[model samples]
Target: MAHEELNRQVRQDLRVTDRTSHRRLREQGSTSREDLDAVLRAGFVCHLGVIVDNAPMVVPTVYGVDFVSRTLYLHGSVASRSLVRAPESTVCVTVTHIDGLVLARSVFEHGVNYRSAMVYGVPRLLTHRTDRRGLLTGLRVLTEHCAPGQWEYARRPSAKELAATTVLALPLDEASVKLRSGPPDDGDGPDAQLGLWAGVLPLRTVWDDPEPDPALTAGVRVPPHVSGRGHRTAP
Candidate 1:
């Protein structure tokens, strides 16, 4: 019940700022925190947009979210310049899931069905030596986000390995959420008289059967967490 109330409060209108305000496609924009969480939970990969060396750089990386703390965790190699420099200035993290292609009678009316979220903030870097606990937590969240149960099932990272990793925590205080779904809008327009077959081509992601490494022992069986994942649809 407490969580429910907290959710209700968070679901209220999100704090809108110049960066988060919707200037166009106002109909598809959402200010509800629930909408933002849905967009983040639907995918693990995100594009981190930041300025590196005075040039705009976009890096694709895996991410995880902790709603309780209202933070987004992103990880990468410590040697990566983009990750290192991201803390120097504000950054934008975007996650998008393409649901379908909206086929319309007219070319101008054609569009795509997608759910997207953009978060803007100045992230704080978590170094393994200085912030081991924070780094581990971030890594676990990231690993589990990509492959549920893998973090506990697999061996934990060693000190050297952790030292080479870079983790960034970005607050979820400011964001923009937009979702577009359903059929083409030209159905009731003049283009409707064209009699063209216009509809949505839906897309889905699913996990395939797991393949074992060649060096693995033949008698070893697949873990339940993994074997059960096969043929399952991804969010």
Candidate 2:
């Protein structure tokens, strides 16, 4: 999507407006649906923020996004007060991945290198069965990010289980992305003599060996995707 179309006219006042510093990086923080979808698809976990009783509450949960529909799907238990209280208000969804740690010669220059995306919009309740089914598929995409084949192997949710869960669809408008990478900047004259180890310590997320359920019958093989897993793509 075009930048103009994605951010034609956003509200002047929003929580993200304050968090959005650095105009150049903010522009790099794309509002395009494709960018948002890529960030969402690259990972399963996200931090969801909503107001409850006029106080800010942030909860970590799984999320999925549909670029075509420009919708973000979130799932939580029916008993979750955060979801119940957030229907009428705008919410912020954030996805972040720490790529590396930047260690400088001086302690003051130390920082974390990361890639992150933030999305803001009002969440709408899903009612129509067709839309609900689509949202459920998106949810499955999140739940099985590392192991795509598990969606079929795992027992599907029953009717009662579905009813007890709350699924929310939020628009993909009013979003931003930010990223920082590479080594630290130490001054040329003063720090040249301090031969300290100043470089990036890379971090990565990988799949560990699968642990099957203890009660499972013997001879059930692990799924191909899980067995042949490797490092996930960074957002």
Winning candidate number (lDDT)? 1
Q: Please provide, for model 2 over 1-235, each residue's C-alpha lDDT reduced to its tens digit, 9 standing for 90 to 100.
A: 5776546544222235554444774534554445455667778778888876778878888776665666777765431456565556778889998889988889888888877788877787553353667556655754566357787888887766665566677776567777677788674647757987788999887666668889989998877877666444344
lDDT of each: 0.87, 0.68
Per-model clash counts, in order, read 0, 0
Tens-place lDDT per residue, model 1, 63-88, is: 99887899899975431456564446
Specify the highest-TM-score model's number: 1
For candidate 2, report its TM-score: 0.78
lDDT, candidate 1, residue 185?
95
